[model samples]
Target chain A: MRLSYPTNIRIIKVPCTGRVAIIHLLKAFEKGADGVFVAGCLEGDCHYQSGNLRAKKRVAYARRLLASIGVDPERLAMYNLSAGMGPRFAEIAREMTAKIRELGPFLQPSGRTAAPQATAA
Target chain B: MIMAKAKPLEEILSYLEGFQRILVLGCNGCVAVCEAGGLKEAEVLASALRIQNMQAGDRRDIQELSLTRQCDKEYLAELKDKMDNYDAVVSLACGAGVQFMAEMYTEKPIFPGVDTCFIGVTEEQGVWTERCQACGQCILAETGGICPIMRCAKRMMNGPCGGSEKGKCEISVLVGRDVDCGWHLIFERLKKLGQIGRFAEPALDKDWTLSRDGGPRLIIREDVRP
Candidate 1:
């Protein structure tokens, strides 16, 4: 892919991408993240059984969420890489950085448009 | 069984800050999947409200309830007598469920305590994604089981919107990431099937009329009628 992303792209290395909750991604967006990405193992090569699959499914779900609120689901991504694929990790980071550049900084609330300011109780 | 979670402590706190008597309500369905505002959520919100009230010296009434479902008539009917007791409600249910509660009890003020994120599954421990947009049109057969409507940044039924650069969304004006456009997924599938030409089939315009648009929709089956 022909793209470059900002260095602000944070890499959260987890034991397994499958363990990354949707809320974590939403929180990232809520806190004003422009984009989010998850790197996992190849289908048959996951360290834990099907961790990559789980991560992929989670990514797909989140992608749609990003789209629903107009941020474009492409902002959230999932990729597969083995522990030794330093190249793959770097590639993902580079690809993500490029995408974020195209997408620019996040605008509006992360998940949903800000609700009409609720009156303080 | 998809689990849902509630909003952070602060989101609800800000909404409830001005109310004098706040009622925290929970549902037993989908929202309970990730613990957003199920019974546990109600308790947590109740406790949090007390803490906030003490801090502010507002001392809101802060009543609590975990109904079978705030979306159902029978379940909401259970709240009639209890409704008159509180000034407002802090709901932990999905938006529809919360609205049903408000509709059933017109006098009580209602507020959503959880954001309805999406119609998705728990792919792993905590990850939920855009599985179904409820576009009222489903075309999962042509592509691999992956849903283009929900996963694609653009809701293009056929092909990726012009924005897909490298398996990511071009719309990311904020955090530019490689475009893995939804069409990219469909293209990958067609490549596997050796039928890239099939992209010409026009995806019918989605009909959202079947969704929440009709306002206060209800479905009752003859077999399940109580």
Candidate 2:
């Protein structure tokens, strides 16, 4: 089923969410992504075992770092979903897109809207 | 190993205020092992700084470098050719490494990225406990390998003072964690070694001159001199 999600979202594939380090998430924001999210396998269902959990921790850390720099920590988030939940994946995409839209475009510390860049992982 | 923690981001940013081009330097020695100041940490800091700068509408040039060990002249020599590229450096090494780097490159400003905590051992993946004070005296033989200077909140020579309760030091309340009473550990260790008699022996006042109080101590090994 070709469930449609917001086209603004760009997904970068990795072998596992564990492979997504803090730098990767921060770099996305540094490059001007309005929002970023790590879509990992559902907790306890990670193919590589604990990859999703590791991603969860890293996402939390990155969020704190973002908040420290005055960025909206809500701009970065992590979600867990199984491979079979394509509809839920689409739903999450819509939900995040709406949230980001309501939060408006991410502004640099200078208060200027950042140039659009890839926004999800 | 030396244990350290990152300084607050605001403090580090303040150091970079006037410097447009910055180098975030890391040490692959003790700071690396403790997960405080290493190549990965350097990258994370660099990225965060970049994001902060971009948000502030400031175009700051930030780069990263990691030396095998910043305290060694041989390793610091690697920066000889790269020093001219940046106006200042943010070092993630321990205090000694930062000082050594600052001394070598006198023209540029060097700031510490992490606060050096203590000489410690990794109790677990993310837990580190202070183990030594480098007091210039070794008394592990008598104390059963437990150090009193660093562990005991009061630096008790003969202790388990009234402040010690349930094997924890009174200072533990202020630190928000249970700190093992140094004397309690000593007693237990000495008992295990069948040297409980050592506890009865009075300890003389520690020689303050043998410690940092003596001021910048030095050692000369003629046999190893080139």
List ranges where model 1 is wrong by over 4 Å. A1-121, B1-5, B8-11, B172-179, B193-197, B204-226
lDDT of 1 by residue, A1-121 (tens): 4344334555555777767766566656555556677777777877688777877776676565555444577777777767676665666777776776676555532243221100000
Give candidates' CA RMSD values in order: 16.2, 2.2
Question: How would you encode candidate 1's per-residue C-alpha lDDT over B1-226 as one tens digit per residue?
Answer: 3345666666666676567877899898888776677886676557545534543445468777898877789988888787778888988889888888888878877888887877888777567655786755467876666678777765677777667777777766656744456778878888888877677677666666665565545567999875
Candidate 2 lDDT by residue in tens digits, B10-80: 89998888999999999999999999999999999999998888778788899999999998999999999
The per-candidate TM-score of the B chain, in the order shown, comes to: 0.81, 0.96
Tens digit per residue, CA lDDT, model 2, A17-95? 8899998998888767888888888788877888889889998999899888878898888888877888988988888
Candidate 1: C-alpha lDDT: 0.68
Task: Give the number of the best model, judged by TM-score.
Answer: 2
